[model samples]
Target: MKDRKSARTKETIVRAARKIFSEHAYHTASIRMIGKEAGIEHPLINYYFPSKAELFDAIIREICEEFAASAGEWFDAIREREITEGFTEFIELLMEFNRHNPEPLRILALNLTQTKDFSLIPGYHRFPDLISRLHTLYVEKIKPMGPDQEIRMFLHSFYFLIISFLGAGPCIAQVQGMDPDGEPYREWMKATLLFIFLPRLKDINLPRAAAREDG
Candidate 1:
């Protein structure tokens, strides 16, 4: 069943490798396993990527580019709305993004979140660009709220909680005796996140011009 001559061998390999990496994480996944999952000869992988680390970087870049494009669209879509309306829409868009792109979330959990040093991946260099793209969208939350210690704490909470939700939401749902894939839990999570975050958005004044300028 190994068809090495496929015209899209590189793409095939990437798809297969993504599955393996997302399932196994970086340390446990091997190129040989990727090749087997790819139904490709091991040497053929070298033609596309110099090494496993480079391939991992390639995947990270792919995900970063994908997210950057999505975040831009999300930012534009929310620009005209009132603050609460925009924040609500943004959260739904993020949930939809996670639903559609669960693989990226899973891969992130596997490779990044479990470790104290998230820079464990060789592709850490691309993180600044990724953060820049996200930060652009993130400013919507920060702008009206202002970048205080509370806002910083909110960012940390958002990252840790959202990632945890995405990674283990089903198990948590099950523990609560809810259907993991049912609408109930999905709605519950959205409502829960809003409950946690919306209070911060309520009644917050934008920083004064003087304070903004000083910072």
Candidate 2:
């Protein structure tokens, strides 16, 4: 009973923190605010989390673990497939994931871009491995133009773009006079990825390393 109570208390804190942090970026959010939102004393929050930074990190770690459990298989399958197929599947999965879990992504997108010290996110350490897999997919499977540097930049840009797009998708849709939840918009995004983005990627001039490998 004690453990169950503790678990509920912790979850309540996290849920309150998630809501507060999402509404106000990390730096702007205070433990007092979180405690008030959670209906607990500020000291109780400190008892559960040493600092605001630690609390923030806990939320990110929780989000990453949950995302991994849900989407890990899709990433694994991407490693097994051809680059085009993998990339298409990845984009589709991202759209679906965002559609279902908008809150976490919104929290992440806001905090990540606003913060300079990325060490706040405990899951950040795993990012290198993630990028490494993408590098292999590009170099070994697609063999896209340019060297690893170019591929790294491409991947970074895409990651930011996708996250930002999903985070601000509704606002963007409104601005563009489109419905974010509409099937037509989703289909347009699918076609844009395949016909436009993929085609443009194909146009990048091959670096000497790639050209030599081809030769």
User: Residues 103-130, candidate 2, lDDT per residue (tens digit)?
Assistant: 6767767767665676665445555555
Q: Any idea what lDDT model 1 has?
A: 0.73
Worst 10 residues of 1 by lDDT: 203-212
- Clashing pairs for model 2 are none
Compose the digit string of candidate 1's lDDT tens values, residues 1-215.
Answer: 35565548889888988888778878888899999998889899988887999998888788778877887788788765665677788778877898877766677666665566757777756756676556656566346456556554665576567766775666688998998667888888888888888767543433433354476
Model 2 worst lDDT window (10 residues): 200-209
Candidate 1: list runs displaced more than 4 Å: 1-7, 140-145, 148-152, 203-215
Measured by TM-score, the strongest candidate is 1
Clashing pairs in 1: none
The lDDT, on a scale of 0 to 1, for candidate 2 is 0.70
